[model samples]
Every structure is written in C-alpha cells, then in structure tokens.
Target chain A: MNKTVNQKAWFLVLPVFVVVAFSAIVPLMTVVNYSVQDTFGNNQFFWNGVGWFQELLDPSTELGGRFFDALWRNLAFSAVILAIEIPLGIVVALSMPRHGWTVAFSLVVMALPLLIPWNVVGTIWQVFARGDIGLLGWVVNHLGVAYNYVLDPASAWITIVVMDVWHWTSLVALLCYAGLKSIPDAYYQAARIDGASRLAVFTTIQLPKMRRVLLIAVLLRFMDSFMIYTEPFVLTGGGPGNATTYVSIDLVKLALGQFDLGKAAAMSIVYNLVILAVCWVFYTVMVNADAEKKEVEA
Target chain B: MARIVLDELAHSYKPGPKGPQDYALKRIDHVWRQGGAYALLGPSGCGKTTLLNIISGLVVPTEGRILFDDRDVTRLPTEARNIAQVFQFPVVYDTMTVRENLAFPLKNRRVEASVVRRRVEEIARLLGLSRVLDRRANNLTADMKQKISLGRGLVRPDVAAILFDEPLTVIDPHLKWQLRSTLKEIHRELDLTMIYVTHDQTEALTFADEVVVMYDGAVVQTGTPDALFERPEHTFVGHFIGSPGMNVLPCTVEGTTARVDGQTIPLAGAYPDLPQGRRIELGVRPEFTTLAAKGAGLPVRVKRIDDLGRVRIARVDLGGRPFAATVPEGVAVDGDEASVILDPTRVHIYADGHLVAALPAGATAA
Candidate 1:
C-alpha cells in the first residue's frame, strides 16, 4: 500500500500568516525601533542606548513613579476582577435552567455587554455614573451617600471597577455556563444518586469539570483588566489623582500626551513584557496542570 | 435491598389525558423483588427510559405512586431515593482520576477512607479497571470510561438499587458482550437490585431474570425470557421481544379455529368471549412456524432467505402480508411454493389490544 502526501495544504495557512505578519509583526517591529532610539520633533532621532530603560527602572523620576504605581494597580485590579468574576459567574451559571427558552434568553443577555465596543462601554459608564443625570449616581446621591465619581478618587475607582465588572463578568459567566452545559446529564444523575448536597455537586462535579474553561476565563479577564485603557481613560480621564490610572492608561499618556517617545516606547515594551511574562506564567501553570492531568491518566 | 413497586403509574407530558393518545405512559402496576435483576425493554421512544427515570426519581409521574419496598416514595427526590443510575453514555468526572471518580459517591456519603479505598479497589478489580485506577477518565477509551461509570455506580454497596439506562450503548460491539457478562457477574456478587433499561431485546433477555417489555410508555408484560416468548399478553410484547419478532396476521376466529389468509389453523383451546365484529389478530413466533407439505399449511412464496449459519430466516409473503419464518438451514423449499405451519400450542390470539387466547389454556379473546 502506498500513502499519498499533499504539500498543497500549506496554501490554506498562507493567508493567515500574511495577515498576522502585516497587522501584528510589522507594528511590533516599529515598537521595537522606537524603544531603542530617542526621536525629537520633525522625526529627528538619536541613539539613546537603553537610557529610557534605566530611567524606567529608577523610582525617583516621574516615569518611574507613574509606571510602578500603574503596574501594581493593574496587577491588583486583575486579581480582584478574577476573584469576583469567577465565583459570581459560577453562581449565576448554576442558577440557570438546564434546558429551555430561558437558557437561550440568558445566553443572549449575557453576550450583550461583550458585544459592545470598549470605548462605548467607557462612555456608557461615564454617562451612567454622572451624579446629576446618571441613574446610578443620582440614586446614590438621593440615598445621601455624597457620591461624586469624577471628583472623588475612591468613587472613581469604585465606578470603574463596577463598570468593568458589569461589562466583563458576563464573559466569565458565559464561558462557565458553556462548561457547565457541556457536562453530561449523567453526572448530575450520579450525584443525585450519591445523595450529594447542592454544595457538594457544585464543588465536586461543577467546579472540577469547569476548571479548564475557568482558567481560560481567568487569564483572559486578567490580561484585559491589566491592559484596561479606554474605559478608565473615558470614565475619569485617569483623574481624581492616580487612583484609576492603570498601566495601559499611563502608557498612552506617556506616548501620546507628553510625546516622550523613547521613554513611552520603552515603557510600552516593558508593559508588554510584564503582561507577556505574567501570561506566560499563567499559560505554563495551565499547560502543566493539563500535562499532569494527562500523566495521571497515562 | 428493597422491593420496588409501581402502583397504577401513568404519565403524560401534557395536562389532562382525555384519551389513550394523550398519555405518554399508560397506567402500569408491577413489582420487582428485592435483589432481583430486571430489564425494561422496548424500542426507541417507548417509555422504557421514562419508566426507568421515574424509578430513579429523575422523572415524577403524572399520576400513581412509586414504592420502594413497602414505603411510598413517589414524591421523593432522586437523592432521597438511594438509587444509583448509570446513563447511556459514560459520565465520569473528566478532571478526576478513575479512583477519584469511583470514590466520589463514597466521599460524598462521608464513608471512611479505608472503606472507600477498599470498595473502589474491589469494583475496579471487578470491572478490570484496577490497572487504570489513577488515570483521568477523559483520557480513557469509550469502553474504559463506561466501565468507570459502571464502577462508580457499583462502588456504593449501600445503594438500595442500581439503575442502568443503556450503559453499554457507547461500548464497542465486541466489548458489549464482555461488559454484559461482567455486569451479570457483578450483580451476582453484589446481589444488588438492578433495573437495566435497554431497547435491545438480546441484552434484556440475557441480562435480566424478568424482562418487562414496555411499549408506548406502558409495560405490556413482565415475565421470564421463556414465558414472555411463549405467552405474550400484548401483541407489541411478541413483536418487540423476539429476534425476527412474532408474525401477527389479521384473522377471524370461529370456535377453536382461526381462518387467516383463507386457511384454517386449529386453536389448541377455547378463546375468551370477544365482541362480535371486533378486529382480531393471530400471533405466532417465527421460531415455532415450520415448513410443511402443501395443502396442510398457509401457502407462502419465499421472497428472501437469510442463512444465519445455524438457522435460516425465510422472508415470505403470507396472504400478501410480509411474514418471517425461521427454518432449519437444510430445509428444501422452492422460491414459488413454500408453506408454513404454525405450532397450534404456541399460537396466540388478541382481541381489543390484549391477548385473548394462548393455546392449551382456557384462552379468552378479551
């Protein structure tokens, strides 16, 4: 018997490679070029030789001050979002009906916020949190809470967190719901037969089964939260001080606001590196967990 | 172990079953002895699964009561029923190891660690899964995963009854036989009250001591394999329980003889008083019908012959109605001239949708 090998299959992937190189690789190369050199007005450039990187490492300068603070804030935000969204998503998913028109309705509703553009989400929240016209702000004010999100750093932070939660928690919920739905009805039957309590069912059957998708949900949410720019930028304009200024917001301000191209470029590189490094660690953990799972099976 | 009983159970998906067509499952009254192996057998959408789910407390009946032993458990949740159910497909925890999957129910019940380990190991050994005890269930093959599912159900000896809902459907054909025998062995060793549900007649007949043949959501007959074969109370039972199924021919009965297809066949006993002008049918197993000399039987034309190694099945036309007859492999008959004689003692007569007569009995076509 002879086997046929077709080299023509490479043509299928050629388009994807071309598109990715044009959109992603070209821009990344440009970012690398800016990171290594100092460019003044009229496109005049000087070789800075890691000068921006050194300045970024130093804590005394404004760059260092904003960079480290934003980095820490981004990390904290990702953690908080992950902590809140995953459990909340699981709870919501569990409460959903197994099979019905309600499942379709809930899925459509959950997907609505994810479909809205990021900038639009920011604008919606900004208007929605206004003390005078916004329903949430008006309600809080009416309740005698003395809330002003634009002027108050604490309120601004709260509003951004709440907005982010409202916008992105649905993604986690939908992913978890899909995971839950994929589980065979047999497991529930077995659990019922075992006399497992509701809590037992969730912890043993639901949580363990959803682990893979839950990891994906957490990683995606973390990366998105860490690099959040448009929503906070539009919501508070990184105002009420640095309370709402995330790393991506700071990166934008340095690159476009002040035109400190070298420092901003270097910082952007560093920011990307940080996200990449953290994401690598998360990816490694997920992959190793899967590998270990496979090893156990083997 | 508990004796499961169903008392006047009928289920309808919609409200107010005004007539026969409205009910998904007609009223059934039966009892399953404690520690007995029983199978609910029927074709697809035949309420066999529905009845099994009702027994497992997964589906609540529209009417009637389900009793576990003597205690009424109609309204009890599945968790409260103390029944372990294995689904058609394997439902083991994909993220958990085989050991963990088997131990889950035990762990949920707060069984002692030593006992859980011992019981899990025992079941794993029984199912030939001990070698893969630590393997994650998702990585296993379909048969292995099904074995894990089966072991999970069997691990808890304290379960009142173990219900299998076509648990071997995902298993390969060759492996299904082995698993069936393994299940029978486990049932013997554990002496658990097992109610197996399957559409496969072979599986039901071979696996269960008493096979409950269900049709259109009601159990038409519950008897041993031989009894069900010999004396089917409903026409559906006769059709569903056999390999080629029973040949049912419309007939008119006059005293102790039925005239089917213009041929008179002697009835072994008197039939029950059936209303005049009521439609009647005569039922006979293909195995009991044999080829005989011409003028002594119903003349049939041999349409096709399937030589099944040991026995040959002849597909013939009896009075323009397609009928099957199992004959010896060497039986000589031309394609044009074949006559089949149904054993008088093995024939059945039905009236008003119920068996009215069985040969050699005080047969009533009621």
Candidate 2:
C-alpha cells in the first residue's frame, strides 16, 4: 500500500511561520547569539564560548553568588505568595454571593483588581505604603509598629508580597468561581439528602470539582510569581540591600544597568529554559490528567 | 418503615398567592402506606417533584402538616427527616470509591462502623456493585454511577422512606430495564415505603403497586395499574396513561345516550342531572374499541392502520374527530369507510374533565 505525502500542507503553514519568526524566533535567535559571544563597546563582539555560563554557575564567583541569592529569593517569594493566595482565593470564591443583584455586583468588584496594569498596581502600592503619606503605612506607624517599606527589608518583602496577592488573587478566585458555578444543583441536593455536613460537602464535592481549575491556578500563579519583575521593581527598586532582588530584577540590573551582555544573555537563556521546563511539567501533568478523566467518563 | 401522610398540603412559590393558579402544588391529602411501592406518574411541570421534595422535607409546604407514623415532621430539614432521595442525574462523590460512596450517608449519621460496613456490603451486593466496590465512583459508566447513587440511598437501614426522582433518565436504554427491575427487587426485599417519580408510563406502571397519576398540580387518580388502565378518573389521566391513551370525544349527554357530532352513543348507565352547563365527554380505551364492517357499528373513515407488531391499531375519523381503535387480525380494510365497535360497558362519561358517576338503579341525583 502506498500513501501520498501532502507536501502542500507546509505551504498552508508558511504565513503563521512568518509571523512567529518576526515576533518571537528572530528575537530569541538574537538572545542565543549573544549568549555565546562577548561584546565590548562600539558593537565589537568576540567569541566567549561557555565562559559566561561557567561563571554564572560557579557560586564562589561574585556573579554566581548574586545569581544564587536572587534565584533563592525568587523561589521563596513565589512559595510565600502561592501559600497565601491559593487558600485566600478559595475562601473568597466560596464566600461570593450565590444569586440575585449581589452576585453581579460582587463579580464586578472581584474583577476590578485584575483589570489594572501590573506597573500601575506596583505604583499604587508604592504610594500607598509610604509611612508619612499613605493610609496603610501611616495607620501602621501611628499604631506604633514603625512601618517603613523604603528602609526595612522585612517591610519591603511584605509590601511586595501583599501587592502581588492583591493584584493576582482575583484571577484564582474567578477561575474557582467559574468551576463552582458549573456544578449541577443536583449534587448539592443529593448531599443534603445524604445528610452530609457543610464541611463534608466542601471536602468531597466542591474541592474535588475545583481540582482542575486549582491546578491551572497554581501553575499560572507559580509562573507569574517566578518571573515577577514589574511590581516589585516599581515598588522597592530591588530594595535596601538587594534583599528583594529576585532573578528577573537582578537580570534587568545586569543586562541594562551594568551592560554585561554576555552574562545577561546567558542568564536569560537559562531563565527561559527553567520556565519552559516547569511549564512542560505542568502541561504534561494536565494532559495526562485530562486523558485519565476522559477515559473515566468514556 | 413508617406510614407517611400529607394533610392538606399545598405550596406556592410566591409569598402571597391569591388563587389556585398561583400554587405549584395544590392541596393534597394522601397517606403513603408503610412498605408499599408507589409511583408518582405525570408529565413535566405536573408538580410531581414538588410533591416529592415536600415529602423529603427539602421544601416546606406553604400550608398544612406532614406526619410520619403519627408524628408531625412538617418543618423538619432533610437530614432530620430520615428519608433518602435519588435524583434524576447520578450523584456520587467522584473522589471516593463505590464502597465509600455507599457508606457516606451511614457514616454521616454516625452509624457504628461494623453496621456501616455490613450495610454497605449488603447494599453493594444488592446493586450488583460488589465487583466495583473498590473502584473510584467517577471511573464508571453512567449506569454504574446511578447504581452507586441507589446504593447510597439504600445503605441507610433506618431511613423512613426512599424517593426516586426519575433516577433512570441517564441510564442506557438496555440498562434502564435492568436497573428498574433491580429497584423493584430492592423494594421487595427491603419492604420500605418507596415512591418512584417518572414521566414515562411504562416505568411507573411496571414498578409501582399503586400508581398516583397527577395532572395540573393535583392527584387525579391513585389506583393499581389495572385500575388506571380500566378506568381513568379524569380526562387528562385518560389522555396521559396507556400506550395510545384513552379516546376522549366531546359529546352532549341526555338520559343514557351521548350525542357526538350528531350521532348518538348509548351509555351503559344513566348520568341524570350531570349539573348545569358543563362540557360533557365520553372516554374509552383503544383496547375495548375495535374495527368491524363499514356499517356494523359507529361509521368511521379509516385514516391509517398502524401495525404495532403483536397487534394492529386503526387510526380512524369518527364524525370528523380523530380516534384510535384496535384492528383485528385478517380484517382487510379495502377503503376509507369502516366502523368502530366500542364496548358499551367500558365506556365512561366525563363532565368538565372529571368522571361522572353513574346513578344507582332506582336512585335520583341529590
């Protein structure tokens, strides 16, 4: 038996390829090119091979030490915000008004924070957390806690974390709300007939139904928090002693602030790979879970 | 295990209903006998589910009280009512195994572990879910999930009654019969007062010893399957039950004869004084009406003959009114002209949709 090979299909895809090349591939290729070469002033470039990558990986060196510190800081920040946001989002979702005029009103209110620009969110928090002028900072200081995000490391971390939570937790809550709404009313009726308590209903029915959306939420929040730069950058400017200098902040400092092109490009490539790798894991897990779910339904 | 009673029960969704039209469920006074298998049969929006929910205490009726074994449980919540209800769609805890799903209600009520285990095993065995007891409830066919729902409802040994709200709607066609028979068998063994609600007449007739036929928010007739088939109390019941339903033709009655279109139909008994100015009608099942010679009985135009496998039915026009009557075997219908022979004893008279009882011999309408 012989089958015809449809080479003409490739032509059908050419337009998309061209658009992607101009939008993503070319810029990525430029970054890849810079990662392997050193550039001095006047656009003069020379082959640096893997020298920047080696230096970046070596913790004993200044560059490597700073990279590790920012890496750890980024991971910790992601972890802290996720721990705070996920449960808070679920609680908010559960407490949302179920019906009547209040449901639409509450939905609009919940969506307000997510509509703001990221940098705008950062700026709002920056001005809002000033000890002398801002309401939150002034109230805290007046309550005698000596709150000053500009000077204190702990205070800066709190402000950045809180800002991220305020800006993004709504996304998670909205996703969970959608999941909750999709559930048929029969399940709750059956639960009532089965004499299930409210807690049991949440654990067995609501939580299990929300699992898929919750996974998506975790993956999204994890990715966004890992690469978080705009909010913290605008709010603290990498902070008092590099305490809030996450990987993206430090990468921006190296690439544009210090003009270390080779090191910055190498760091970016690694950063992209890390995100891709994490996203790949999440995608694989989600696909496999979806297949399993389909199989069960079938 | 307990006799349930609905005493003057009525429900209206609005706060203050001014008339009968506003009530979702009209006033109902019924006594569900202990250990009886009953069915609530009706079309959609006939308020059968509203009645069931009231029984299960999910919705408190706007008026009247409910009694279980002489104890009033009118305002009780579902959990405190000690009744189990299975919904139209299957409801099982997706994360739990079939065993866990079956055991949920018992565990919720704090039944002893050993008792819960034994009851779960028993219910699983009865539902044919024993083989899949360890499998996740979600990882099953819709029929199996529905069986799990049934098992959960049955596992509670002390439930006052079990209500099923069109529970087999999602089951496969072949599986529906199997599940229905299994439900009947469970009802037999458990001997619990069970009320099955369904729109399909076959399911209701086959499952219930006593079928309560409802229409327009009221119970029109409550009788055995045979009784409903033989005599329908209301015109709606006559039109709703049976395969082809009873033939209801508008007529005018005087003494013992019913005049329809201009032809007269003799009545089996007298319907004297059928009240002033009410619509009169005559009803007879297709089973008792048959086709014959063109001039033997009531003249009809043979419109169509439906060969329903075992027996053939003739769709005919009686004085411009469409009617159905059985066509006997080997009766060759050559032309549109024919006659329908209706069994005089089986014919019933109705006034304004309600049956008009025949006056006894030597008696006068009071």
Candidate 1 per-residue lDDT over residues B251-350, each given as its tens digit: 9887788898688988788664656777798999999998654555788888888877778888888889999988764677754688888888888889
Instruction: Tell me how far the alpha carbon of residue B211 in candidate 1 is from the true structure, in angstroms, after superposition.
Output: 1.2
Check candidate 2 and list the clashing pairs: none
TM-score of each: 0.90, 0.96
**Candidate 1 interface RMSD to the true structure:** 2.4
Measured against the true chain A, the candidates' chain A TM-scores are 0.91, 0.95
Q: If you superpose only chain B onto the true chain B, what TM-score does each candidate give?
A: 0.93, 0.97
Return the lDDT, model 2, position B212. 99
For B112-184, candidate 2 gives per-residue lDDT tens digits of 9999989899888898998999988998989899888878888887787999999999888998999899998
TM-score of candidate 2 against the unseen true structure = 0.96
What does the lDDT read for residue B123 in candidate 1? 89
- In order, candidate lDDTs are 0.86, 0.91
Assess the local accuracy of residue B350 in candidate 1 as a C-alpha lDDT between 0 and 100: 90
| Candidate 1: Cα lDDT at A175 | 88
* Residue A13 accuracy (lDDT) in model 2: 97
